[model samples]
Target: MDAPRQDAWKDEEDLLLATTVLKHIREGKTQLEAFQEVAEQLHRTPAACGFRWNATVRKEYQKEIQDAKNSRKATRTIYSSSKSSDDTPMSLDAAISFLKEMKTKQFEDYGKENLETQLKKLNEDNEKLREELKQWEAAWNEMDKLVHWVREKRKSESGV
Candidate 1:
């Protein structure tokens, strides 16, 4: 029992969504990211874009999706191997994918390094906090002992 949507997707919008999704796949980005990008362009929510893609557009682009994944794999292989043939000229798609792959690697490395540094700082802070807590606990125990001793001495002196 769903209400009818006021605005329907046009053919061009569907095409745009399809192509953007395929391009994102080839570039090693997720479909949700593609949906967000297309949503911004189409003035729709990402959920709407994702629904439209899965419900309608995606069925038509199955082959393209496979091709995009293969292209991404190929791009990775091309960049990872040092033994590519110099006689063979690289296509524009391959060149662009190569650059994208490199950029993705740099971003991943930076993220890992940044996370390690944060973890080191957090561990140091945690150790400091533990030491501080132990010191406070020792001080509290000493204060408790002093209070008990004072009360016992007063009781002994007053014969209470």
Candidate 2:
């Protein structure tokens, strides 16, 4: 009793939009800020731009958010290689090493956060793709039925 379906390309557009928004949100920006910026830039509504921030995406970025907060705090301790040499102050090598260590720590934390966010985004994308595939299959099936019905009707009318 339902009407036949037509070809629809919904997922492709959704993917493009989703990826763009996800990239922005992952770049250490707030969801609302990213959404608003992306939406305005892309000439889209905020709601349409926000579909990428689903539960799955939120869960993925949650850890990164915590890590970022932790990373911002001072974890470096200034140590002078020649402690007795107060006049000389900290050695250049020691200062360099300490700075490198701090940089390394910040990088590692950000890397982990970024990785988790990307993984979550990938999972959400996969889910959306699967849903789109299902919709396509259903639409194809409906179209096939309609075509067969039309063929049968034409043959019968032509006495074939």
Candidate 3:
């Protein structure tokens, strides 16, 4: 039998009720007891008090769940191996000679890893740009089609 408010429950009232409910629960009161007390104090039903309590607490736990998921991803290790195309058999001396020549011809490339990473980033950026371009082109094409249709209708109506 409380007066109806133009807006939803006020922030101060919600915080006060939530604090009271949490305190009662922390003091070893059952949820039912805490809910009843909060419901009476807030001039709301038991269900409404329970709903608000759940909304407030659920948000906090949801954040914690997301934090745990992010931490798990950060702690994981990724491994990858490159494939080689050599399938022919060669003598040990020839293999060693080829390896030595290959190593010498290729400068000690400290930047190889960096180059590959940059290439991957560039490829991803290119894909994003391509997608945006496609969307823009589609929108422009639709506009052009609409304009042509309108012009054609106008010409027919004018008997040209």
Q: Best TM-score goes to which candidate?
A: 1
Ranking by TM-score: 1, 2, 3
Q: Is candidate 2 or candidate 3 better by lDDT?
A: 3
For residues 1-160, could you state the per-residue lDDT of candidate 3 as single tens digits?
9978764678776766656655443333456777788778778888877787677644644554455445433322110112435454544534444556457646456368768989999999999999999999999999999999999999999999
Clashes of each: 0, 0, 0
Better of 1 and 2 by TM-score: 1
Q: Quantify how close model 1 is to the true structure by its C-alpha RMSD in Å.
A: 8.8
Work out the TM-score per prediction: 0.53, 0.38, 0.32
lDDT of 1 at 131: 100
Predicted structure with the largest lDDT when compared to the true one? 1
Stretches of model 1 off by over 4 angstroms after superposition? 1-5, 85-160
Question: Which lDDT tens digits does candidate 2 get at residues 1-160?
Answer: 9765453214554455455545443333356666677577667676656665562344555665555434333212324232443454544544565677778978999999999999999999999999999999999999999999999999999999
lDDT at 150 for candidate 3? 100
Instruction: For candidate 1, give the lDDT.
Output: 0.90
User: Which stretches of candidate 3 lie above 4 Å from their native place?
Assistant: 1-7, 57-160
The lDDT for every candidate, in the order shown, is 0.90, 0.61, 0.63
lDDT of 1 at 46: 98
